[model samples]
Target: MIEEPKSLRIGPDVGRRPSVEQVAAFQGVPTGFVVDAMFGVGAMCVDISPLDTSNVQVAGPALTAENRPSDILATLGCLRYLKAGDVLIGSAQGWQGCAAAGDRVAGMAKNAGAVAFVTDGPMRDYDGILEVGLPCWCTGLNPGSPFGTGPGQVGTRVMVGGQPVETGDMIVADRDGVVVVPFAKIDDVAARLGAIQDMELELDAEVRKGLVLPDPIAALLDSDKTEVM
Candidate 1:
């Protein structure tokens, strides 16, 4: 008796992607604020960072891929779903020994108009990939090739960098790091960005004047039920 092969589950493309203009507005905003104070949650990837420190920033709707360990067929299949403002994010189960992509795939993804590529797994062709000029964020680089075997999914919710992501989620990435904003929260976050930046700038100006820690910190430390130990 022969074992039946596992079937690949490809979800349909989401009908709605967050506004490209609105998402792109987050390009200059620090991921620190977006993740720490704005979103008020951990939507940032803990292990993912840009492969090249080229002062590049990327913001776009997500095109998600879930690849089986050591296999990237679903990633290849996801190419058709790419648009001018899409970021291809792959969940490779956090595998670090095999590359999820390389120069060839990165070039193809760029040609398809993808703004960036991200993966929980490593990627190959670091120098060549940077030369292609597509922004990439990943755990690291590995030279091992992935199998083309089936049994992966595309355009579906997947886990990457310890965060759950869905297709069309707004992904804002820069030198600081990648921050994911759910589609439902994109507008809300965008609306709050201005006020947050305003306050941050005001506070920065005060600090630059050699101002010491403000009354809030003193009050908190002085009170605290008066416990000094």
Candidate 2:
């Protein structure tokens, strides 16, 4: 029997990264609280909400004793394209492979290279993952992650779980967590997001100083009867 592909599809190198502003504008907190320090394994997504999930897709790397995708190798290869402070914010598919522990991948990532790893699944090697100083982002910790058919195919748009990830994409990660951008839209998005972030920081400073505003946002918050948090 012939296997059919999933309706949602993406190709590698489509060229675009979600701008910080774009993602921030559409950001929503996950239904279940995600741990600040998770194993960094499951998958990656725009939001846990039903409306915000579909953003990027990632096909995980295939692994085995002899054919495992090396975190060190991928980091070395990715470094040529990424800066020392750059981030890798796509989804992972290792959860599909239950044979090996998540630590193996985390170790690879921690010791491998790049800023850090991000996923929506479980993660292992908490000690090693943290020790490496590769700040990670993930949903939860899965003891083991499964494998996929193969590795990145040069810009193939594969959904790590809910989010979409393409090859050669720019990623932004910080205390709030990780964000992935498509290669095509990095400049425009980054520039815009910079502005938004600055504005927010400015507002945050004022709020800290007891600045009060009956602005539209305040009205909405005052009127809202229900809150998720």
Candidate 3:
């Protein structure tokens, strides 16, 4: 007979992490810019939004946890894995029946050195979380509580906000949404960011000067490619 599964399974810590300089490069950068750097991908679903808009905007390597529906054992376990500047990504498999985290959890995450908490499921203890002052992003709020029962995993790959997230992946979030940069693509994305920022800045300047249409769109409208009926 097969042995019963463990109540909790904590995977090995991430073997690789983005360099400090690389991580710093993403600090203060908007989620939109990160998406552009990745060629219009990497953004999480829009439904996961900041709990406190004023406290939005954070970038850090992820410490992932996977929990079952109406449970938070994995999230609680993941806290010990947090490093300074880490972002705790708690996955409830998009379940919203109960809270995935709350004020006490947020306080624990902060004490563990996590910069932010992101969850695909809803959360509770809104006022307490705000008082704890830990940045958080979630689908919404629920007053219901969750169980601590296990069959959960920590420091493992998880799907959150409809995106596959790994422990070492870089997570960037703001008022717009969360974005995940795969660990393998961190350097490549960072290399491309400068050019993207330059282009965006140039366009912003042109828009300030009362430019009506973008050059590409204008060219398309003028070309034979356009047929007016």
Q: Please state the error at residue 154 of candidate 2 in Å.
A: 6.6
Across residues 156-213, which tens digit of lDDT does each residue of candidate 1 receive? 8988887778898888888877888887888778878878888788889999998798
Q: Residue 137 deviation, candidate 1, in Å?
A: 0.5
* Residue 113 local lDDT, model 3: 93
Better-scoring candidate (TM-score), 1 or 2? 1
All models, RMSD in angstroms: 2.1, 10.8, 1.2
| Top TM-score prediction, candidate number | 3
Which residue pairs come into collision in candidate 3?
Answer: 7-151
Q: Tell me how candidate 3 scores on lDDT.
A: 0.91
Clashes of each: 0, 47, 1
What TM-score does each of the candidates earn? 0.92, 0.51, 0.97
Residue 148 in model 1: lDDT: 81
Residues 121-192, model 2: lDDT tens digits: 445666655555555565554445454433333234545545465555544444434444455554454355
Determine which window of 10 residues in candidate 1 has minimal summed lDDT: 36-45
User: Each candidate: what lDDT?
Assistant: 0.83, 0.41, 0.91
- Tell me the deviation in Å of residue 185 in model 2: 1.4
What root-mean-square deviation over C-alphas does model 2 reach?
10.8
